[model samples]
Target: MRRESRVERSTSDMAGGNRFYFPTKAPESPAFYTGRAAFMDTVDTLERAISHARRILSARQLLPVPDFARETFPATKPQWKGMGNMFNVVGTRMRPKNYKKITSLLNQLAECYNVAHVGDAPSVARATKNVLDMFGRVDAPIEDLEGQKKPVTIDDAGRAYARGRRKEASARVWVIPTKTTDNPSVVMDPEFFHEKILKSYRKITELPTTSVLINNVPLAQYFVNPADRERVLRPLKLTGLLGAFNVFALSRGGGTTGQSGAVAHGLAQALAAHVPEADLILRRALLIRRDPRVVERKKAGRAKARKKYTWVKR
Candidate 1:
C-alpha cells in the first residue's frame, strides 16, 4: 500500500513551476507511467489512486487479477475542477442481464467507514429502478393486476423481484453498461473514454443507428490506403460496425476496444437524449440506444476489467 518515490523531485527557478513526483516501474521495464508536477493540498488524491494501484500491483485479497494484454498503467493525478473530488468508476454492461448484481449495487448504500455519497446514492437508485423496470418489459412475472402506476420507483423494486420483468424497456438492450474502474486520484478523465466509448461499441454490435468516430485518428491513414482492410474492416455482416464505415477513434487507455465502444455508445445515447425517438430506430437498426451509464462505475474492478485476458484463438 506504500511506494517510495523513485523519480528525483526537483524545482528550478528557470521553469519555476509546481513540484513533481514522477514514478517508474522497475529498471527492467519501460517507464510507462509518469505524471506532471503539481501542488497537493491533501493526500486524498494520492491515497485514492494507490488504492486502485494496490489492487493492480498485486491483486491483493479481493478477486483474481485480470490478465490485461499490456502492463496496467497507473494514472497521473492531474489538477482539474471536480476531478479528484469524486471517485472514478468504469461503467459496465452486466446490469441488464444480472439482476442480482444490480440488487447488490443498490444494496451497497455505503457501508462502514463509507459515509453517505448522496449524489452517488441517487445514481445507484436510478440504475436499480431502471433494471427492475426493464426486467418486467421482457419477463413480466407479476400477477397483481391491480396497484400500479406510470413510471416505477424504489418501492417497485420488491415487485420486480416477483414480476421478473420491468414495466417498460427490455433487458436485451444492445448497449449494456459495466462499471469497470474507480480511480479517485485522476484529474481529467478524458471525455472520449468517460463519455463516448460504450455507445460506439453498442452501435457497432446492434446495428441500430450507424455512427462513426475516429478515436485513433492516426490510424485513419491506414483506411485511406484501403489495403489495411486487415486493420480497418470493410462493410460486412458479422464484422458488424467494425466492417463498414471505419470510425477513427484515438484514446489513451481503457484499451482500443473500450475507446471505440465508448464513442459509439455515447453517440447513440446523445442521439436518443436529444432526439428521443432515435433510440427505437437505433435499436431496430441494430445500434443499441445506450443506457447512458457509460462512465459511471457501479462496482470497482482490478486494473481495467475488460483489458485483461490475453488472446486465445482456439
Candidate 2:
C-alpha cells in the first residue's frame, strides 16, 4: 500500500519525464465486469466476490442464494471507497457507472462455468476458489471510467479462457534459487513444494524459485540470520518429498497452445492455493500468451510455401 511519490530516475535518466512502478499484482480482466460491479456495490458484499466465484462455478448449487431478493444491487462503504479511487486513477474511464453490467458478466461467467465443469464437483470447487482468489480484492474496470463495453459474444467463453491463460502465463513467474548446497544461482532440482499436506489440488507444475516468502517468518528474521529460511521453511514446505510417488512438470494452454498449458497453469495455481507466499515461487515462471500467428518468410519459394528444391534460375 506504500506509494512512492516519484518512481523515477535521476534527471539524466529522465527523457520525457516519465516513470512508474508496476504493481506486483494487477486486477482481474473486465470480462467478468458484471461480477466486479456487483462486488464493488458493497463492502461486506466483499463476500459477493466469493459468491460470484461459486455462481460462476455452479449457479444452482455452488452459489448461495440470498434469503431475500432485492430490487437493486446493494452498495456499501468499501464499494464507495473503491469506486471513488477507481475514477481518481483513470478519471471517467470506468464510465456508465452501471453495476448491472457487472452482474450480467458474472452471469455469463457462471454459464460458462456450468458448461465447462458439467459435473465435476471438485473442479467446480477449484474454479470457484480460483475466481475469488484472482479478483476478490482487485478493482473493477476502473479503467472503464468512460463506460466502455466489451460485449460478451458467442466467442466470449473462448476469449475469456484466453484472457485467463495470459494471466497465468505472464503473472508472477517464479524461478527456483538453489541453496549453497545446491548452487545458489542454480534452480533447485531436489526441492518440492507439493508432496504432502495436499490432495487432488496438489500438482507439481514447475520447478520452484530459490527465494520464497514465509508469512510467519518476517518478525523473527529481524533477529536471526536470513539463511535460517532453509532450515525452517523449506523443511516444512517440502515434507512431502518423504513419500515415493511424485513427478514435476511444466504446462500451458488456451492462449493458442490449447489445454496442456492450461493444466500447467492450473497445477501452479493449485500450489498457490491457501498459500499466498507460495505464489511468489510460481511467479518466477514467466508463462503467458504467445503470438497468435507465425511469421512469413521473406524469401520467395519456388516450390511450396517455404520449401524449395535446389533449382536453377534458368
Tell me, what's the RMSD of every candidate?
24.1, 26.9
lDDT of each: 0.30, 0.35
Model 1 TM-score on a 0 to 1 scale: 0.21
lDDT of 1 by residue, 243-301 (tens): 11223333334534443334444334333333334446556644443333344334444
CA error at residue 209 for candidate 2, angstroms: 22
TM-score of 2: 0.21
- Assess candidate 2 and give its lDDT: 0.35
Please provide, for model 2 over 1-314, each residue's C-alpha lDDT reduced to its tens digit, 9 standing for 90 to 100: 75435444543246556654556665454423555442454323434654555565455553343344222222211112233454442223343443344444444444334333444565654554355333232123444333332322213221111122332332122222232223221112343233321543544543332233222223143215534323323322442212221112232423323322333343344333323354565565432223234335456655556777786699
Which candidate gets the maximum lDDT versus the true structure? 2
Local lDDT at 114 for model 2: 38
In candidate 2 the C-alpha lDDT for residue 299 amounts to: 62
